[model samples]
Target: MSGRQLYFKCECLQKGGAFKFRGACNAVFSLNDEDASKGVVTHSSGNHAAALALAAKLRGIPSYIVIPKNAPTCKIENVKRYGGQIVWSEASVQSREEVANKVWQETGAIFIHPYNDGRILSGQGTISLEILEQVPHIDTLVVPISGGGLISGIALAAKSINPAIRIFAAEPKGANDAALSKAAGRIIRLPETDTIADGLRAFLGDFTWPVVRDLVEDIITVEDSEIIKATKLCFEILKVVVEPSGAIGLAAVLSDTFQKNPSWKECNHIGIVISGGNVDLAVLWDSLKKGK
Candidate 1:
């Protein structure tokens, strides 16, 4: 974990504009013929819904997505563009889940959970598999944690590949349940969420908690300003339009939060997972020039 080379994985370049595709595709593929034919339903702030919609489209199955009323308009449009039906709920993750469950009860649609299913984890694991293949010896990996699906999947795969690799989860201070949960040694729910990183606001699932608890090395929380700064940096330095949640790993690195630990800097290479790229260009441009 210390004095090892680190490399970064830019999964923002992943298909469907985010790393969610890997999990969505895997979950859909894991379904039996009857299940797939019956279609799938899930709730999401944005990225996961789009990924699942696209995945269902690819599989020739229908997808029903429950989205919050205040979800980014662009994401809602993407879901429709990808041939998914949208069920709108109050502007909250809890409302979205309730709506999704209602849809499931009525339609018998297989619930393709946004971040809580074992098959989703297996699919998300493929991201680590790809990263390992791309970089031979990654000593430390920093991944954004939202409900712990992506990080849990990545940790499981990365640890299996090299037990010595250190896996860290980067979270926004506004949605710091994972950080708190890790400290409490149990799943802890957020009383209220107010982060710009909409995709990272959900609480960790029961299935995901166990995987993350046993496998992840640590959770690092960053401020909203830092997330904005990192998002701008990615656009300016890396020429990528990364969402706030997606840029958190970069934020952890750029803000020197990780570097605070002497041992962390000792690692020559650090791998950060740029999880998504579904930002509204106009909004991102405004954010980029805000303090300039």
Candidate 2:
């Protein structure tokens, strides 16, 4: 546990069981009446697919979701339940994007990039507004980083409100492109990723990279084992069923890098974003049974 006072912004409790709902909702609703009628399309591993589907349903429009064939069964069900037309693709980004593009072209659905749109970024930023309002004097925020929408929006809004507030990205060591990008002063994509935090495997995008580069203070990378431990802790201690990606912020805060750094001492009150709670129950039960 961290010595500093900790605050959790539980976006996992949101409509679609993830902070992804905020961005998806904003994007879907921002469309003009004509565009909305034509439907919306996007590619996602899980959460965003479900979020966009639910948002489109609320707006009385169709949602075409391009999902990797390997996505969790529970998440695929979420999309179906929310009335999305599912299109399957290979797990790779190129395959996902290619399928999404083909769907958009065929259906004339407005293409919604998972984390690279202005509307989505603005919507994700709302989390920071609520966090600052609730924790007026909080000094630092630890956010999970995937394609960078959540942290980019949070850093932009939080820094604008209190220019000195620190923003750190909690990234999976297996998918540490954000960390590499920060070090290299540009986006960096890995050849392949291997992490249990399935939702955090994405690299930064053009729309999000600028905000991350300018406003984020640091990146704290944690191993998959650490993420798993933090996920279990969320269920046992926090009484929250957080997915591995959602628990990465807590993992980062409790990691040696954050704990031993003297510079981090100034962050007396740290806020952690619990970004989602869409774990596969079968995997969870199996892990618990195996004492993982």
lDDT for each residue of candidate 1 in 1-292, tens digit (9 for 90 to 100): 2234535567777777888899999999889999888899999988899999999999999999988888877788889889999988897767887899999899889998888998889888998888889886677788999888999899999999999988888988998999999999999998898777878888899999998899888888888888998887777878877888888888877656677777676555678898998877776667666732
**Model 2: how large is the Cα RMSD against the reference?**
1.1
Best by lDDT: 2
Candidate 2: give the clashing pairs. none
lDDT of each: 0.85, 0.93
lDDT score at residue 58, model 1, on the 0-100 scale: 97
Candidate 1 lDDT at 233 equals 77
lDDT of residue 139 for candidate 1: 79
lDDT of 2 by residue, 110-157 (tens): 999889888899889999999999999999999999999999888888
